[model samples]
Target chain A: MTDATGSEAGTAWRRIADELEAAIGRGDYQEGATLPSSLALAERYGVHRHTVRQAFRHLADRGLVTVSRGRGTQVTAPRFPYRIGRRVSMRTNFGAAGISVAGSMLGAEIVAGEAEACAALRLEEGAPLWQVEALSLAGGIPVSTGVHLLPVARFPEFDRVFVESGSSITAAFKACGIPDYVRLSTRLSARIASEREALLLKIEPGAAVMVSKAVDALPDLTPIHLIDGIFAGERMEMVVEPFGELPSPPAGESGA
Target chain B: MTDATGSEAGTAWRRIADELEAAIGRGDYQEGATLPSSLALAERYGVHRHTVRQAFRHLADRGLVTVSRGRGTQVTAPRFPYRIGRRVSMRTNFGAAGISVAGSMLGAEIVAGEAEACAALRLEEGAPLWQVEALSLAGGIPVSTGVHLLPVARFPEFDRVFVESGSSITAAFKACGIPDYVRLSTRLSARIASEREALLLKIEPGAAVMVSKAVDALPDLTPIHLIDGIFAGERMEMVVEPFGELPSPPAGESGA
Candidate 1:
């Protein structure tokens, strides 16, 4: 409870922030949910809206909420502990977060391997490759859209098998006799999402999207898959535990 | 040289793409610079603009160029190989890229440590701390803007010392008797930049910016600094080598 009886304006905001923090801690305001408008809060507290804004700033500085222009203040959600280890599987990742991922298969075709994919797979130029497009969802929330390029020589009809496995890449790999694989390398960048990507992810066209280019390899370190992923930035935060469970590679070679 | 003589429209784009790739390899067109407009390229090659666009798409798929709607196709710049290791230093990173970083100090003040910084630094809430703001540029290209919170008890007058050291955090640490420090933990996300941040980084407002929250600790694992960095995402790429040079941490605790 805050003493609203003519307290100093500075301490007035402090008390408001304290009360809001307690409410948030009690789960009255859920994460990724907006709080009352400044005017509304001000009316309830009998203080100026500026005081309410000050309180919001305090909470934002404490990492409990975020304040953006045009968008009201919202409770900050705890970022998903996205692990970027050798084995990078979307299903495994969301499952670890206590959420089941529903994967949807998008465009699938047999096409000539592009130069980038060919180099990563160590195949000759114009090699026949299976190109598969897919999306992963957690609790019906789309997480990422990816394009997978696999050498047709290695897995003759991976696209069809992928759909047959309920869009589970792991199941498809297992069906193809790959019991285990490791992510060889991953490069991360962020940029404004294009119209097509935003439409697929159901986000604003100008929203941020994290672009990841990764290569997955077989147990023997043979490149098997080239993946390009576009992730809705606001929905995910990647945690890279570089040396968490794995030992360092040999000198002059890192994550090859 | 590509034969301008009539050929199948399909392979015509292929030959044009090959020639442009060779020109790029020869450094005729530098990274981050746009090529001739499609109309101009079409006139030169005696082909329709659609054929030139097809060529652009080929190069884009090959990871050599990026084609945006308004901005013409530009050779993709090699992203800075930003390494996230136990010891993270912007000066060291740009230096390795053969570019010297110029640091500019912004707002600096003594402030009460907010909950987030206090929790990271193991200080009491409202603990007195020195808040320093700075930005780093590489070859006059702004790389990142950061706000650092350091315990005033440990590094009294550190802000003044930082300014005295030519706005170099590394040099200021040395002056404060901290010969070396290691980055304890890092968390990364991306979002649209604020107007002030965009202006500071000289990027367009609403552009994507990678946000990093990190803690730097002394050699004995005592956190000394809490850093919040906003990076211009288009200019940088993060390379996280989890197990590149370091062995695994103790079980159950990683990157502590």
Candidate 2:
């Protein structure tokens, strides 16, 4: 621990908390492991006990550790890892991780396509779309919500197929005679949840969420559908893997 | 607009805000376009002017639009799109978007490898590693901060080469005789920015930040380095593209 005497109390405490957080992340304190006593930490950092206590409070607030009356601060379990690859499927990903997964249809309807959906599906303006909203659960805990939009002309009665197949989009595609599809692209952003989303996900209104907008395509690069998903940030982490070669740059410069 | 008679004022306002935000995102209102008047929106939504005003306030607070005395409300410019792919060069990505990019070295040192770095680099315990901290700027504004860790033995003069090459990690790798590399995997999460990170990125403390942990490797699968980056959530969007075939699934039954 590096001590700078002139730093403010808040900065000092934050620095200490950051160090401890990094340590916990590095598995210095494994899952369910208790941290050292406040007095010991203070002595190690050459700070007052109260300062160490403040640091511990900060860590607890960040959901990194839990404190109880009888027990000391204990680290929380690691988050579940979800890999996004060429043939991505939420069911298969969580199943391989030893977590049972299920999907339930929240609602389904035919609606006017939004510009994003129209552009991604190459539909003209005013095209009707089959929109399906569903929630995915891992071990019975809601982890993500998805809104999928497909061209109604291409996949008529998609909602019926989706519901009849127990809310599996993959199965619904097969019902539409599509054997397989590939992920075309994914755009990621982060923001705080809205009031309605918070209620649905059972989290605070301003809690963090990871948002992804993705388009799936057929093997020949024809888009099939577009999906917008909001994932609970604390419950899942997204892993991205390379699935194709980088597009080569135009030739211009000579070899160095 | 869908209206529910018994909904709370907050819920109604949020609904209006959500609709307007979706419109803006879909380019119904292009960048720098002015939104409809509060009176017009109120009438369209069958709500009072004050309710529409509240919705506008919410949009402003979320950095989606700006309201002025004479000009009314105007949407802001879209964020820079950063595509994460097989090559995954920030310079190339920003250049294709016509944005001038620059990087500056914040700090560098040789430190004992942590678990993540050691595991990614396949290094033994207590191995020394070269760590570099940098800030990437797009159009003269800082957008991301990166902490890169590499094996010291592989690139002994990495720090000097990186600084001399105008803070280009790709150039430094080339200087070390590495002609090409590919991205192996990327993990993404979102959280509130810490005080130090907020200061560095010129954002408010506790604002949302997208964090990515990625490993780059040689063509034959030898890991090169690991990068942990924090991006200002509101300033940039990440685009993930597939670069290889997904791992084949085990033998299984056909369709249901």
Candidate 3:
């Protein structure tokens, strides 16, 4: 009965969501725990089951709940373990962990590199660069959106090459005649996601996101790419092993 | 005077802050850009200058503005660079940046090691651990709060040592016959601050926080301590170097 009309239904669901949120915030529900069924919640709130479903969807978008086919609705858990260290292959790592990931190109454009990008790519300030925006999803769930920068002088028309290669950065690099690359450095911070970012990631507005600025370098330490990644913080954890086994760098070498 | 009484003053300041927030979100203001003077904002809002100050204070607590001496109120920029690599000493790094930092003990208790802590410390499930909570401030601004866990068998009365040693972790380690330790691994995630954490960090209720779970090990890779650090996300950037020079582990040796 609460779903009298369009706007009325909207307001009713939001009210239910707010009450549920307050209950969750007060520890009335625990993480990895399931919520009552939609029919049960509808009866409790004296609303249509569709309205309860809408409320659940809103909470899921906020990263507070997970909706699965057989599992029903459960509190969100950090399920993805992202590895960050020397010699990390996202495809291999997440694949081994039974997570299927896919990348799609959002757009491509040539722009002047600013301070953060220029510093990461070891280019002069305001240098021309090819910027490509890509979104990656795991298990059909949007996980990260990355802004990739490549020096225009080094990789001309790289953006086209990226799209032609199905938005795979590695494929684009190989087409550019680079066999391999290594992550040189990364700087991470966290903040509330902007409106555009939330839309792209399918997360709620103002949701917390982990931002990483990373530089990829060639074998000789020549910087080739600068990547700014925005990760949905609720579903991922970045793992680092400081003493991981890796080859030693040559003595007295400075990265370009 | 619009600010007639206590609750009236509260409502007046919040209204101004909400309007300014909308302006900032629309990109009317830029990062690292100074806003108009308090007097100017007061004239625009038709409120007292004191009311404007309260609005600015509210925004600052939400990580939107910076009110520093002589600098007036500029947008907040990430100023603290936290270095994370093979060897990291918070005191040494922040001190090198000319920022004064102090650590204060919040509380200590004996608790059972949860899954995260047990795995980090390589302890049996449900093992006893000493959990010491401490807060660190940089230039009198709260930056991080850390929960440190140590084996109850090895670090008896370690909480007492921590308190007597001016809440210095290094001093406590030395007193417990640990000459040195190094971080072996770190796992990081980000989320909205809880009620208690927001109060301790002096941030808004739902502000983002970067959580780091780090394990410090002895020279032989025996896990010595587990630290869970909650960092105020707005003012910090965590820097990581993949190729930092460090000694390699001995052949075929596995961490404990």
Indicate which candidate wins on TM-score: 1
Model 2: lDDT to the true structure: 0.75
lDDT of 2 at B159: 82
In model 2, the number of clashes is 4
lDDT of 1: 0.78
Per-prediction DockQ: 0.26, 0.25, 0.22
Please provide, for model 1 over A39-144, each residue's C-alpha lDDT reduced to its tens digit, 9 standing for 90 to 100: 9999999999999988997777545687777789999886565677768888888887589888878777776665555767888868998878888888798878
Estimated TM-score for each candidate: 0.78, 0.76, 0.70
Q: On a 0 to 1 TM-score scale, where does candidate 3 land against the true structure?
A: 0.70
Worst 10 residues of 1 chain A by lDDT: A247-256
How does each model score on lDDT? Answer: 0.78, 0.75, 0.75
- Candidate 3 docking quality: incorrect, acceptable, medium or high: incorrect
Candidate 2 displacement at residue A81 in angstroms: 2.0
**RMSD after Cα superposition, model 2:** 10.2
Give one digit per residue, the lDDT tens place, for model 3 in B117-214: 56557678578988788898888888988788899889988878888877777778889998788777777878777666778889877788898877
lDDT of each residue in B49-148, candidate 2, tens digit only: 8899889877764457766657788886656778777778888888887988889888787777755457567777558888788898888988999788
Instruction: Compute the lDDT of residue B130 as modeled in candidate 3.
Output: 88
| TM of chain B vs. native, candidate 1 | 0.81
Off by over 4 Å in 2: A1-40, A43-46, A49-76, A243-256, B1-76, B243-256
The sequence of per-residue lDDT tens digits that candidate 2 reaches over residues A1-256 is 1123345776777678878887886677888899998889889988898898889876764457755446787786655778776777787788897888788888777777745456668777558987778888889888889788889999988877887877777777888898898787777877666565567778655667787777888878788888888888767778877743222222211111
Cα lDDT tens digits for candidate 1, B1-256: 1123345897789788878887887778888889899999999999999999989876775456877779889998866768777788888888886898898788687777756567668888789988788898988988899888899999898878888987788789999999998877776777887766798899878788887877778877788988888888888987665435322122211101
Which one wins by TM-score: 1 or 3?
Answer: 1
